[model samples]
Structure formats: C-alpha cells, structure tokens
Target: MRRLATALLGLTLALPLQAEWVFADFEAVSGTPQAKLFPHLESAGRGNLAAGGGQLALVWEDNRDGSPQVYAALRDLGRTGFSAPRRLSTGAEAYEPVVLGLGEGRFLAAFEQDGKVVMRVFSAAAQGPLATLDAAASAQPTLAAGKVGLHAVWGRRDGRFLRLVSAPLTVDGLKPHAGAARAVDTSPAQDEQLYASLVATAGGYALAWEDRRAGHTRLLTATSSDGRKWSEPQPLNEIPRSGTARELGLGRGPGVTRVCLAGDGADTVAAVWMDKRDFLSGYDIYAGVSTDGGAGFGANEKAQDVFGAEKPQWHPAVAVTPHGVVAAWDDPRDDSPDIWLAARAGGKDWSDDFTLDGARGTGSQDNPALLWHGGRLHLAWVHRDEQGGQVRYAQARWE
Candidate 1:
C-alpha cells in the first residue's frame, strides 16, 4: 500500500495490535454536487463532520429534490477531491445532520425536519439565512454547548410519551428562554423506542440511545450542562442477555448513533452501533465506552474484527483523535459498499484494515465517511460506479 504511511510513520512506539487484517489505502470519488442529479438520489447522514484547518465539512442526505436535501462538501488539505457539494436545505424529508465546530467560524447542523428535530446554527463561511431551531414531534435531534447558549435534545413523540426533551436554542433558530423541555425517559414500556446520540465534553451534552424500556434493546445515557438541563436516563448497555435487540441499519448518514464526548474530559465517552441480533434484524459494528463521561457505559464492543452479522456494515462514521477512535463504514464485503476503516491507537489497540478505493470510475459505495483532520484521517463515500453515484475522497496521516 505504497509502503503504508512512510514505513508506518518512521516506525516507533512499538504500535503492535495488528492481528493480521490489513486492507489500508483507498480512493474513490464521484459525490457530484453541481446540481443535476436526479434518479432517486439518496445520501443519508444528514450532516456530521467538522474537522478544521486541513479542511473537511461534508454533510449529507440529498435525494436530488424528490424528498430529502441538505448538502455540503469541502475536503481540502493536499486536495484531490470534494468541494462542490453545497445545497443547504430544500426540505421534504431531511434526516440527521448533527455537526458542531463552533469554535469561531460557527457550525451546528442538527436535523429531521418534517418529522420535527431541527436546529441549524450556520456559518461554514456564511452568506445569508440560517439560525433555525425547532421542536414539535422531534426525532433524533442533538446539539450541544453549555455554560449559557445553544444545547438542544429531541426524541419526544408526545401523547404516549416516548420522552427526552431539553432545550435552549438561538444561534438563529430561536427558542432559548432557558429551562423547559426536560424528560429523560419515562418508560411507558411498549415499543417505547429511542435513538439519540449527543456529545459536548467538559460538562454538557452527553446523550446516547437505543431503548425499549426493558423488554430488550438497551444502551441509554443522558447528561446536560445546558441544552436545557437534563440528566436521569442511564442504561449504557451492560450486556448480560444484551437486550434482544434488532434494526441496526446505519446506511444513509447524519450519524446512526456514534456519540463521543471523547476521553480525558473526566467521564471518557465513545459509542458506535448497528448491532442488531433483532431489534428489527441484521446489523454489525457495535462499540461502547464511557470511562465516566456519561457516568457509566461499557459493553457492546464488537467491530467484529472487520465486519459480520451477515456482512453489510452501514452508516457508522465516527471521529475522536489523539489517534484513538476513528471509524468508517459501508462495506458489503464485496457486493460493493467498500469504504471501511478502523482505528483505536491507544484505548487498547486497533488499526490494520482499510479499504476505500475508486475514482477512475465510480459507482455504489454508499455513505461511508470518517473525519479526524486535526490529525488527519479523511475518507468520503457515495461513488456509484459513474454517472450514477458521486462523492469520494481518501486521506491518511498519523505518525
């Protein structure tokens, strides 16, 4: 693989953790975005990437207008791909779009419109309108920032009370008077499901999900320094009989549950999912950690060495750097979903399987993406063999 990372970054630290699973190095582009893409175009993961300096923004879920829409693309660095995608939103059916880089240039994405879950703080560079926030029937919505402003939470189907509230909006979306919607998880039981994931480190925003009261289907968490003051829904998956779950579908992005408050913050947090023994059916790519961040969480660790559960990994796109957590998915073993990668660096060890190839010609690779950039790890997805799928990129740099 081109001598892989210049002799593995000058070789040192003893690295070791490679249990024979090398598939590193990948390239595949065609995520088109100059407009003019219609054939039932499908791009999920509403939007979940930030990475700075070297560049990388890339959001998703743009069904070419028939329904879902929301786009963004930047991928800079040595440059070789992505930078054309730009449609902010048109709306008809937008799913997840949780982003947050608000250091200065500002960012905060958030999604689910039509079904509810909204929030859009704005400023990848800015131009005009933006700063929307919503709440009604809410769906997988999560936004963070505490101490004073911004911080939202969602998943509130009302009537039957499938709880999870929290509020405080206003970067433009308006609706932050302070303290109101707060209901961790009442558990009326039933199918009473939930699928949240929010992270913000320090002392704010730390939510994870997948619940069904107890009948089976676990993994829950909650914490809020501000989003509107929340904290009281714990259940970070302890395994055991491991909730007879199912429905691990992660395809189409916007984050299919891969929260991260990251480490060293005092509660160390990390989460990933797609593990479905049956919550609905087949799924793979499980992970869980929370050294204390959410207070407790640890189990469901099964990246399956590389993939399985019938092979067809989807959704998954995580990032946490210092060289510790980097995930990417969308690998159909070979039927074409290729764009897999796994890294861990120190939380014990991992990294020795990478595959994201395509460009000379592009087609189905679906929405597999990963971003770290503060240390470099960029990889993109959606490369439909050509004239069909578009969106691709590749990058690696960790010494």
Candidate 2:
C-alpha cells in the first residue's frame, strides 16, 4: 500500500549519468588484523573519520593492550596507507571516540573516559591531553569548528534529565573557553535528551538530537547565533499538507534513534537517523534538511529506497559535498550487513541505494564514517568475521 516503488523509480532518475563513485581497495587503519579492533562508531553527532589540509585522521576503541583504550591513526591524504595506530588514553577504559581535523597535521580526539568527556590534541610528532571539557559526568561528545571557534556538545545528567550541554574552545590549543559551558536545550528537567549531532553554519551553528520528552522518542533540532543562547527545539518529522496528501507526523510508531548532522559549508544542514516508524517491520534510514540553518526543517524523507521493511538499516553517517548530500549506513538486506550509500544532488530525490563497490565481500561491514575532502570521499568502517575485527578505510572519487 505504500508508495515505495514510485519512490525508487524517482530516485533512479535523479542520479547524474556521467558521474560514478570509484573506490579504492580497503586498507587497515587499526593495523592489527588479529586483535579485536572495535572502532568507536556510536557517536552519530560526529564520526571517527576526519580530513583537512591534505591529511586524514581516524580514531577508535580497541583492546590490543588488554583493557580497552582509544587509538588513532594519521596519514597524508595523498598516501594510500595509514601510520601505525597510537594509543591516546593511558588510564580508564575509553569508548565512542570522535575525531576532528584541525588543519596543518593536527587533530582533536574526544571520547568517554572515566565517566567524563575528555579531549586530546595530537599530530604525527606530539600528543597531549587538553583540559577536561565537562566536570560532571558526560558521554557522546561531538565537535564542530566554526568561524569564531570550536563548538562541542555532549549529553550529561542534570538532576532528572539527561540534557545536552555545549562549550566553546580555543582554536590554537583546543582548550575550552573559560566559563563558556552551558545547557543547549530548553526542555524541563523531567525530559531526557541524548545522542546530539552538531554542525557549524555560516550564521552560527545547528544541532539535532533524540528527545524523549513527549512520552516517545522524537527527533528535535535547534539553532544558535552563538554557542550561549539556543532556539527552542522543533520537530523534524512534520509532514505539511500538500495538494492531495494529508498532513502526518511521527510518534505513532517505535520512534527515532542515532541522529547524525552534516552541513554544506553555508546555511544548509542535513540530519540523518534510524527511524522505526514502520511498526510492523524494521528500522529505516530517514533524513530531513534545513535550508535556513536549523531554524526550520522540511518534511522527512527516506534515505534508502529498499522496498520491503524486512531487513534493518542502522548507524547512519552523512557528508555534504559540492554536488549535494550523501548518506551511508549499515544495511543487512543482503543477509549480511554491508555499507550502503545514497545521495541527493541539487535538491533532487535521493539516488537508489548502492553498496560501496570495494566493500562487497565476506564479513559484516558496519559503523561507517564519511568525510568529503580534496574532491574525494573518505570512508572508514569496522569489518568483523570469525577471525577478528578490523578498522578499514577507503577512498572514492566521482569520475
């Protein structure tokens, strides 16, 4: 009864005829093929892959040294392989690492350590920790670099609510600005907010998160002119009335989770998430776009064009390129999970779902991280099988 077939037909017609994604062979970023390499991929607010100034940076969690610790690898963008993995955390178990490329061979890595959100600045030559970003217990840290400075947001417990808090950082040393940390959400203490994604726009910044205030999980977004004050959170799943179609909205189903945000280096921002609205089936990847920064969002649309809802799609990541927006996720429709991608170019319908060319083989591919740099798409994901798990990286160019 759904219009899924028509949607797929439209998507097939939207793609560019001459352009295609050409991917290189996957290379191991973790470097240890036998050891268990669990690249931290749960932070949809940010990702484990970052690239800038002809360099690439990746961070993940692995147990190569007995206890779990955060590890990172760096390489020049023109190179095909990454440097040896470097352990960044010395004490306490670390998880959910998110990296940001700060240009000139430097990067910032943030992760959950000892119940707090901690960060470190590192390069090929030196590495050290910065002042802790949050004094209170926090998790799921995401970062964005703005014209003024760097912005960070994470979830922290405040009495009854698990709210989103933010802070500004100095660009030179990646240190938190003095007395700049504050709450970014206006919801009451009884409501819960988690898994926030952030991106810097030309005007200021935009954020998206999973909210449980309405007795059900919903996707909400907010905009800020500065990191101090934020606009009231608004729903992103509202479908306005059109010619022959009636108005509809989310909240009648299982709900939403794993929201990721990406910006087009101007005002446009996109939020992609795993939606469970198909109550009888499984989760699907959905996305909404905000043209005027994050002040308002259009009706939500499916990122994947799979007809049946039997298989589940999870762990979405998005990147905005000069052509348009591309979203990638782990899809199990083929019996084994593989990294799938779709794109919407020039405000057109989403392209038909396609798996990464080099990622189609044995083992399950999951937790994809995407970055568009130097006219190429940089991808990183975890591949696991009977032998062990490894963090793999690949690059694609549109030809």
Candidate 3:
C-alpha cells in the first residue's frame, strides 16, 4: 500500500502552519532617574500602551516635576526604541491619563485636571493644550478614538456619589462641542460607577467598568453609537456574594476592584478583571466576551491557571490580534509577583498560563497593559521598587 502511505503524507503537508507567541526581552521605558515613574494607580482606566499606524505610543502619570503630570513618548517604526519623553499635561495634578492612537501619526489623551476632565490632541509636528470637557470632579478618565473624533468616559462626583460621564471630543481649536457631554449612567447617586474602560468598534464603541450599584462591586458594560447616547449598563458577571464582590487579593489586605476592555475593531470584544468569587482572600482572573458589538456579554469565565486557581492574580489586561485573544496579569503563584499570560485561538479553549516575567526575584510587577499591531504584541507594566516605580516594555511575535 505504498500509494496509500503517499496520499497520507500529501494530506499532512497541505495543512496550515500553526502560530505561536514569541516574547522578547524586557526593557525599561522610563530610565533610571529614580523619582517614581508612571506611578501605579490603584484604579483602572489607565492607558499605558497604544499601537497603530506603524508606531507605539505610551502615556502615564509622572511626578518628576515635583507634581504629578501626564507624560508621553513615541516609538517610531524605523527606530529601535522610543524617543525622549515629553510632558503632555499642563496641570499640576493631571492624574489617570490614557492615550489612544487615531492612525496617521495622530493621538488623543484624556486625564483628570484638578477636579475636571480634560482632553488633548497631538499630531506628528505639534500638539494642543488640554481642553476642558467636563468639570464634575472626575477621576480615572479613559479615551477611545474611532471614526468619531474622540470618545471619553470618566467618573464624576455628584454630591455624595460618583457617576459616569461621556463626551465627544474634537481637536479643531482643541474644544469640546458644547452640550455634547452627558452622563452615561443616570442611576441614583448611591449607585457608584468608576474605572471605565472603552474599546473602539467599527460601528461605535463599547465601554466596560467596575460598577457598584447592587452594594457590591460588579462588572458592567454599555454600548454607544456616537459617544453621547449610551445604552443602560448591564452586569457582566453574576456575583455570588451579597457583600463586597470582584475584589482583588493582594497579600492579606482588603480587596480592590478593577476592569479593562479590548476589541478587534469588529465584533469581538473582551473584558478582563480580577475577582474573589472562588476565594475571598484569593483572586482569580475572569473574562466576559461580547461578539455582537457589545449588545450583551456572556457569562464570566475563569481565565487564569485553569489547572488550579490557588494563588493570587490581579490587574488582568486583554488584547486581540489576528492570531487570537490573549490575557495577561500579575500572579504570585511562584511566591513572587510575576507577569503571566494565556491565549486562545478561534473557538478553542485557552492555553495554559505561562509566566512572562521569567525568574522574577527582584521587583514587584503590576498594571500590565497589552496591545497588538503589525502582527506583533506589545506589553507595558509597572515595576515597583524601593525608590519608586519604573515603566517596563516587552514585545511578542507570532512564529
């Protein structure tokens, strides 16, 4: 049966090539002047990396000027590294800055100034100053740029409670359209909503965040068509506990909540966060998927260390590429905080959790941010040290 054997070999040769993730060595984006770089925020909605138009853009909270301000840097496609860092915030206390790439060497950033929310637009040659978008004592501002100019959402304090506000941004003269800004969530003042994360889709945008409407922290999402009108917020997970929910397990301290969003600019959208549903003092990574343009999200799935979820995992970040979807977070499974990643392709199950920080014995790493562009995956995180914090970067390739 030599002909039969030959036919089997031919069939094997016709199969497609399988893709794998290949990560490069890590590098510090913030050099060693040692005054705390990109201070790690306990809240979500921070933008650490943005990849588009053959370039990578980074923004973070910097305090090198004696007062906290937003700073940015760019990595050109032809260069081996990033350009010199530059300050983007004019306010003395510009906190929680997030950046978005709008293609063609253009970028947009949003941050909290004093007690107001402001936005700034930048081009290749010049940039504009901060334009006041909303003045409602905001925090944890997030920005997403799509076919529209720019979309922003942040937590605004209304008397004794917090609410979510949205605004459509324009760079022409660095001004927001009057009356274009509105509240995304109009619930009672006691129903606090914070830490908003947004993803730009082909049709519009999808926003997700940690909501506290039911007296406990829960993941919620909403969809918007023009950045002004938004649908009602819906829970992404069913919290089992009636008390505090979706809290992080950092050592033995009180639990904290956070959420992040990622999308493929199409139908696929993902939200990842840390929750203590399995173990009150231990955290596990959870993911919610929305395939119908954020109309609704499926049930939450445990995405980290499916084999065993014994240790602590927090600050989960997600990114989608043509290859598939990947989620990374800081885990203490190896007795120390290290970055671990798991990926899934198509309809297959998630791959096993693999450590990306390799042999981490020195510093504590957290706040991992991920982006995929040009068939490459880019990651950024904070390396906490005795002196302060440093921004770290690494790249992954599909082989």
The top-ranked prediction according to lDDT is 2
Clashes of each: 41, 0, 0
lDDT of 2 at 93: 87
Best by TM-score: 2
Off by over 4 Å in 3: 1-18, 33-38, 41-43, 173-179, 241-256, 306-308, 357-359, 385-388
How does residue 308 of candidate 2 score in lDDT?
28
Cα-based lDDT at residue 23, candidate 2 = 75
Task: Give each model's whole-structure lDDT.
Answer: 0.54, 0.77, 0.72
- After TM-score superposition, the amount by which residue 282's alpha carbon in candidate 2 deviates from its true location, in angstroms, is 0.7
Worst 10 residues of 2 by lDDT: 1-10
Worst 10 residues of 1 by lDDT: 1-10
Query: TM-score ranking from best to worst?
Result: 2, 3, 1
User: Model 1: what TM-score?
Assistant: 0.31
lDDT of 3 by residue, 260-342 (tens): 88888888888888777666547888887778878787777778754336677878888988877888888766566777788
lDDT of 1: 0.54
> Each model's TM-score, in the order given?
0.31, 0.89, 0.85
For candidate 3, what is the lDDT?
0.72
